[model samples]
Target: MPDSHSLRIVHCFRAPVGGIFRHVRDLIDAQVAAGHKVGIICDASSGGDFEESMLGEMRGKLELGLERIAMQRQIGPGDAVAAIRTYKIIKKSRPDVLHGHGAKGGTYARLFGSLLRASGSRVARFYSPHGGSLHFDLATLQGRFIFCVERLMERMTDRIIFVSKFEQGVYARKVGEPRCGHALIYNGLANREFEPVTPGPDAADFLFIGEMRALKGPDIFIDALTRGSAMSGRALTAVMVGDGIDRNHLIEQAQAGQMSGNIRFLMPMKAREAFRLAKVVVIPSRAEALPYIVLEALAAGRPVIASQIGGIPEILGEASPALVKPEAESLSGGMVTAINDLEGFQQLLPGTQVLRQKFSVENMAMRLEAEYFAALGR
Candidate 1:
């Protein structure tokens, strides 16, 4: 095994946001606590002024070093430039392991890794698709192009880590069955962070916390809520917590549904804020590869009713029959069912901890650390 004392690691990713960003932060914290050298390399411009807050949060969680890479753009030539910059950084620091998250980071790492290997640089390469472009909802020509790129890139990676088994299965099929070096590492929630510490929202209060994009199915969520309200004969209050390209469209839908007073348009919130004000947390995603928001909702002792897509089945397991189809009518019926079976949903609450253990930062880091060593043929 490579000496743990001497192992240096770098986590590369696109701009920081969403679950992958949080995962990297948590992993860095765990690595630091374990006395390993860790650094974060990503475009710092995604979240505006939150860079300091994110850095502070990591520093408070564990002692570690961090580096912010310049993100010129989210795609194309800018990505190529970012790759060169990443390669230069890798060459300078010469990390024992080069791990990547997301599409931009994965492509850059694989390219740099190939160059390093050709130059006889003894550095191990690992990739975690905190749900890359391929895992995204792509029904069009653009999606096909992304799938092709993903397959082409897999040949260069040493091992690919999936945040959910469903993602791994889909990716394995896409890349071909003989593809080796794949691992399933479910994204973990901060159980302590979500434990109910305050009185939740009023009985009518429900919340949706995620990017307000079409893929997240915000419109579908609103449709379900409307249907559920009509069926249950009770007014439902909702707070949509997030922003994206589809924000205006979602707002218009909510207005059309006349859910404005009962449904508030709020800015995206941290985990604590999300849980504190929510009675029920809804993840009506059209496609998801194991969402952290749902896991966090469960950890907070709230009922989560999400679609049966991507890695969600793994999270709900066999006990909770909560997965609904992605369409509005189907999800509407599911929400109604969830509301009618409050007792059953409550029973499912305890089971959240079962999958909760699977997502611990310590476990994820340990597994990754093991992978890094194994990549060196240790």
Candidate 2:
């Protein structure tokens, strides 16, 4: 194995947005700073100028380089072509560690890692689910199929990294305990992120700045915003800053509900920038594996209101007022309370000092680097 400090790592993932992208970015930044060779291979179909800007920032940081191509979010005929293309790319990079984030990325990384090994290449294969297909109920056919695939893929995985304990436990229960190696590592942020983001002069009352999808609960956020405003007898202003499969639909719904005056839709930007534009940040995701938005918002000293699903409780405290059920009505209550008494919710947030100790990019990268070396039997 190469020296732990000089390993070649390639990260594979689908979308270059949301928490998964943020998680990879934090790790890549830390790893690159540590003088390790790192690269990224993700989908190029969705992101616009926003993702291009993110890639531009990382150009010099990734010594192993970046390759964005045709990658799909679902399993289909296109996957075979994509996989062949991905295998050829991985072969050229000659990565010491092929670490995959999300489902499709996991499949490609592991399968290609095995194929490389068969051709006498030594590469440590790692997979982080990143709240992928695991959200499916085990009772359904799709859930059962996904779980079966997970079991088969375990054979090719050198180290399975679960970003949160909730994800680890869910994988264990749904797919049965993994027969191979695994570790639970929380998503973390850089030290600078823990510093407060002073709200701008024209900050909105609230911000919902994640992917525009039903699963992430953009619809629920609008509903909660409408309800919260009605409950508090105020026409609160908010911003929805992201684009996705449901962005236009969500915007139309908000407009139809007569919220055009109160709600504004915008494109995705840096989380820090989003923080500065809002008094409070809200993550209404229906499912997650410890979202970075929650950590970013809290670290920036902005009050957060998040759903009580997946590993959110681990960050927001098990009994935190910010943690609410994944329903419009439940979210509305939190919003109403927060909108009516922002200072009260502000005081309940966990301290930045506490977060600094628990979630640091340095710690996360060190642990993951150690895992990579271990996978290579170094």
Which digits, one per residue and each the tens of the lDDT, describe model 2 over residues 231-342? Answer: 8888878999998999989989989888988898999998898888878898999899888899999999999999999999989899998889988899989888887788
* Candidate 2 lDDT score at position 311: 93
lDDT of each: 0.73, 0.89
- Among these predictions, the greatest TM-score belongs to 2
Over 4 Å off, model 2: 1-4
| Candidate achieving the largest lDDT | 2
Say what the RMSD of model 2 is: 1.4
Question: Which ranges of candidate 1 are over 4 A from the true structure?
Answer: 1-4, 49-52, 59-65, 69-74, 136-145, 201-204, 349-353
Could you tell me which residue pairs clash in candidate 1? 188-359
